[model samples]
Target: MSSAKYHQIKDHILTQIRSGQWQEFQRVPSENQLAQQFAVSRMTARRALSELTDAGILTRTQGLGSFVASFKSQSSLLEIRNIADEVRERNHSYSCAPVTLESIDAVAPIAIALGVEPGEQVYHSVLVHFENDAPLQVEERFVNPELAPNYLQQDFHTLTPHEYLSQVAPLTEARHTVEAITPNQQMCTWLNLYNEEPCLQVIRRTWSQRGIVSFARLVSPGSKYRLGGHLTFTKRS
Candidate 1:
């Protein structure tokens, strides 16, 4: 099928934002104005606006229209399972849609995450995690070629990265860090985020018995995914 009108309009707005033409927290044009400018249906304009809102690029409220949001931050606490699994344990339905998967040479960031030399070979995958049909997270990940030779051969729609890795590589050690990520236009569109809603980005490196297994960067709606744990101090003699 041809590209959707909303997607085209969304891309245009994102281009403006990336070009610095649309400053942070600034109000975008009204839906009617955008529709007229784009020569699209009002519903099409609405779709574009909705897409931005889901991507955390813009915030929308009842009768308030839409406004841009600042860059988001990523946050993570000690957690062992996928954020989807965490939400599911609370009785909510969690699902994922695998978008793209391919083998590629590792870039600098991927190499760093996988603890490999830059330009090394790796397997890359992009998946969107959803909670009850609403886009919740975007997972961009790389796998060590030596560890997961057939990474792209498996069916990710039926098995999550955590699940697949657990079966093949069984985690032995891991390092996880969190930070804020101001997503690009594509990421925002995939996650259905708003510009105003910052996102939580979790960077995880995992090892198996042999060596580095996988490195994954997980991005999610900050409002939906939160980590909490209780701590206690022990007395020493």
Candidate 2:
């Protein structure tokens, strides 16, 4: 059968599963049966099934048939403006745990990122962002003490870092670089990511009118979170 026929049959099967026609843990139609129904070869039907199974949408058992896999994670790539607001907008619960909030001396790399002199004291915070009780992202940040004084006294659990920063210091400009990376031992334990699974890492630096206010390293499970940027072009005459 043609690839078009295979796609059609695959989509039909997916729709059935998604629409609750084939409930979870229920066996999907066999390859031969699906081929007969779609008037295609068994090879074409098998290919569709194999691809879907690889995608984590279907589970196939030897001597049995395919079943729908649960734990479907929804991911969206968006800027880190207000994670709590975004999650609530999507009707998903959002929460955070401030792991460490303290004042620390900036090292060479961190000083450069924060646009500060090396050995300068800065406010540091480690936070874990969550969606519906599942840990989603880990944020390790260093803030300019001049911009955010007495930062450690404030409670981040009640107010997110983004919210507090926006209230005190409106962001003037932001820079970001994203990459796929392997999780370290600490990250694996926090994000619950397997060793072989790739995680998305975003390095962001935000500047206020005063100067660079903060530099943050954001790490999220690739399977559960996605980062995205939006842009609009302007014409110059």
What are the RMSD figures for all models against the true structure? 11.3, 18.6
Best prediction by TM-score: 2
* Candidate 1, 93-198: lDDT as tens digits: 8788999898888654355456577678899899998888889888888899788787899887767888888888887776665666677788889988768478
Estimate candidate 2's alpha-carbon lDDT, on a 0 to 1 scale: 0.76
Model-by-model lDDT, in order?
A: 0.74, 0.76
CA displacement after TM-score superposition, residue 67 of candidate 1 (Å): 36
Kindly provide the TM-score of model 2 when superposed on the true structure, using C-alpha atoms. 0.64
- Candidate 1 local Cα displacement, residue 76, angstroms: 10
- Put down candidate 2 lDDT per residue, 75-185, tens digits, no spaces: 223455687887788899988998999898875446545666668999999999889989988988888988988678888787888888887887777756566778879
How well does each candidate superpose onto the true structure, as a TM-score?
0.63, 0.64
Show the lowest summed lDDT stretch of 10 residues, model 2: 69-78
